[model samples]
Target: MSKLFTSYDLSGVMLSNRVVMAPMTRTRTPSNTANELTALYYAQRASAGLLITEGLPISEEGRGYLYTPGLYTDEHTHAWKEVTDAVHAKGGKIFAQLWHVGRMSHVSIQPGNQSPVSSGEVPATNTTVYAWTEDGKEGPVLPSVPRALRTDEVQRVTQDFVSSARRAIEAGFDGVELMAANAFVFDQFLSSSLNTRDDQYGGSIANRQRFMLETIDALAEAIGGERVGVRISPFGRLYDLQAFDGEEETWASVASALNERTLAYVHLNYQPTITAAEVPAGFGAAFRKAYRGTLIGAGGFTRELAEAELEKGDLDLFAFGTSYISNPDLVERMKNGWPLAEPDRSTFYGVIGAKGYTDYPVFDAGNESLKTVA
Candidate 1:
């Protein structure tokens, strides 16, 4: 029997299977609020053992892209409740992916037209954020220059995460995953090339890592560690994150430190095809040896590759991303060896009224035909 189809205990939460739906930014919420469409989209694909929501900004300042929802404020909480309720109705478990886009922002999106904050004053050259252009149209534009965060301001960001975690639980999420990957706030601090601060949060590897660890600790204290998961990309080069000194040691230290905790799981975003930074050979085996807790490996995983890794004990859960977009019944189709429909690349994002979001048909095993579900 394949472990991919077996049940597993994620801390106290029981997952129906080992198949996870990886977080993909759909840019469907123009109002920055989860709505009936969002709820319906998730509900349609609830068969995955776990569904990680797209990056939910903790505050307006944390937002980098347009249409991605926020998780702070009472209104945001209320909006998300609909999504959680819908997912739960179908026996699906979901985790909110908390996000802060650090230096990846523009003046049009930032509150008060202030510069985006980061570990240092450096800017993400040649990088673009999906924000409003000068012509009042939503499109990609160059990110604004960023200012270095003060030491006290750094602690305040951790508090922001704690507050968001509380709201996630209030909004009925089973758990929350910290968005520490893809050159975000935490990733910016982790990169020595980007973070030049002299405070307790920069320079050496340990100092650079302090910001993320502190935020994780604060979140764990607020909402039991078992309800918290973190996503990281080792040697990731997305959004101009350059290879820094002690990169390998930094990831190893992170794995070792996380191993000491009793958290829900540590999700590794292993996308060699997406990022310019190629993971060193055998890094997965090394990381597995370092972190003994429940591990999830996402990015570019086919059913065969996922099963191979699961059988070898390299990963506990496998997250499928693109396949889940066109095939809502992904787990069932994979289990039955059914063919998958390709997703429309153009409709991958935008508030286009579900032309590609929720209109994807599910395979009808009863009659061998595809049937559309509202």
Candidate 2:
């Protein structure tokens, strides 16, 4: 059997395989709560060794896009229980990816129509958040200018993450993954060009990375370090983030710092197709060397590519995002070499029903039936 199909231990949790379902925001929850549909969606893809949920805002202020679920309220905890139960029933482990958009948000999405908060007073230029437009309809709109967070208030944000992680445990999640990747709250602070704060949270790379490391430590304290995971994108240019000075050194520092902690794994969102030129040479190998713990690699990975990396000892697990959308039986199909299905882009987000969400059927080699049990 291929290494990808073999069982492996993730911290203390034993997975049946090394394939992970990467979090993809489908925006199905208009009320900002998970429902039976959400349970069904995850349950269908439970074949993956582990399932990382879509970004769940730690607080209302942490939200940036509309229709995404929130993780602060008791009602939110209660709602997610169904999803967790379903995934567990199918013998899968799931992690809630806690998110705070920071400045990548619109005023309409903020509480009391307030501006979004960030490490500095900067707006994500040329980037649009999924929010209410001028006509009161949900669509893409320019992110609102944000206010710089007071130095004292930085701890409050970290507390927010701690609070949410506790709620995730109550919701029966096996673990939690911090959404430190892509241009979210931690990314806002990590980017040298974006964070101009004169406080202890900005200027130098150490200060810029302080907020993220503090939050990670707090989460580890609240929930055991064994149940925590973090996702980061080095040299990531998403959401107007620029390639700044000490870019390589900053990421190397992050890897070195994470090595000191006893976390579940470090998830690297590396895309060779889009970021090969920008990412430093041998970056993956360098990160693997710095962080000796389990490492999961995401971004356009096929079975062949993932196997190659595993052979090289660069990645412990492989994450599939878009592939999981249309192929709930992705692992089985890959293992059996079955043809894969394509997802409908139009029905990718903001959809009300199970048309594009839970309606994907599993592959049947015998051609006897094509219905999805979940």
Candidate 3:
């Protein structure tokens, strides 16, 4: 039988198991800080070897989604420290995901309802942002035309990532993952279709990859490369996905560009996008040689499939998103091959605390009232 409960060492930090809690946006935090109840929420899921937080804004202007956490302020740092302290009490490791929306966010989230600042004020082609409505879960309104960022401003954004990462470490997080994936600000610069700049930050693939790689380097300098991870969705089709399929040329270029830095790990978010025909192939065996660190394959993988992929020696870690959402004891389930409880679709994003969050029960191993069988 396969040992799903095997412990793995990631840059001197040993995970209790292969399971890692993928970041899911929960808009329940009031004042944009993780509270005591939020501590309980993460502590309850401490059974997983590691946990990565929902997207955390790097600056006030970087906040795209409402109610998501931020690490820019001192108050926010202390609040996150409380949550991390709780996880430490249970011997679990957690990392915060640094994020920015670029053009995918509205001005409401920004300072003056101005379009989100980006590499170029280029409006995202076919993307809408999800803002918190009074009713909850409704508005994905068309955002304002973002103002293009000046060369100096682009450099500032990259530096901002480093500052936010330092704050995350101060807040007691073990590490931080750069939110380079998805249709956020990093994506804005990465996607050739979105960035039409004539400057150093645009034009060819090398120019497009400049901002992302620089940001990663900045974060690595702030926090050691061993403690820094980069998440990228090679063929992500979010927010005006015209360059969705670079075919082999695009993805290979992406991997080659990221070749300089010794990343802690590179996460490939494979999802069925509108751009390509093949289900977005994550960094499988092909990238094992390209990247010189742990390779994590996420976005739509089942336990059986994960095990099959892991056996190939290409994938070092796996991130379970939705499956881990409903089953807080997912590691144990994989360990015993136990049946999983189906998640309630209605309650997946539910507002109620402990309802769909922590109500799931664990296995009954043996009777406590055992006879003297010595």
Please give each candidate's TM-score.
Answer: 0.98, 0.98, 0.90
- How are the candidates ranked when ordered by TM-score, highest leading? 1, 2, 3
Ten residues in sequence with the least summed lDDT for candidate 2 = 270-279
Q: Write candidate 1's Cα lDDT for 1-374 as tens digits.
A: 67789899999899999999999999998889998999999999888999999999998889999999899999999999999999999999999999999999988999998999999988998678999898999999988999999999999999999999999999999999999998999999998889999889999888998999999999999999999999999888888888998999999999999998879999998658656578899899999999999999988999899988877898999999888899999998998899899999899877558888999999887898999975
lDDT of 3 by residue, 27-121 (tens): 66657777876787777678787898888988878887667778898988999999999988988999899988788777667786666887676
Off by over 4 Å in 2: 273-277
Candidate 3 residues lying further than 4 Å off, grouped into runs, are 1-3, 125-127, 132-138, 244-247, 271-283, 350-352, 363-374
User: Can you rank all candidates by lDDT, best first?
Assistant: 2, 1, 3
For candidate 3, the 10 contiguous residues with the lowest summed lDDT are 365-374
lDDT of model number 3: 0.76
TM-score of 1: 0.98
Per-candidate count of clashing residue pairs (backbone under 3 Å): 0, 0, 3
Candidates in order have lDDT scores of 0.92, 0.92, 0.76
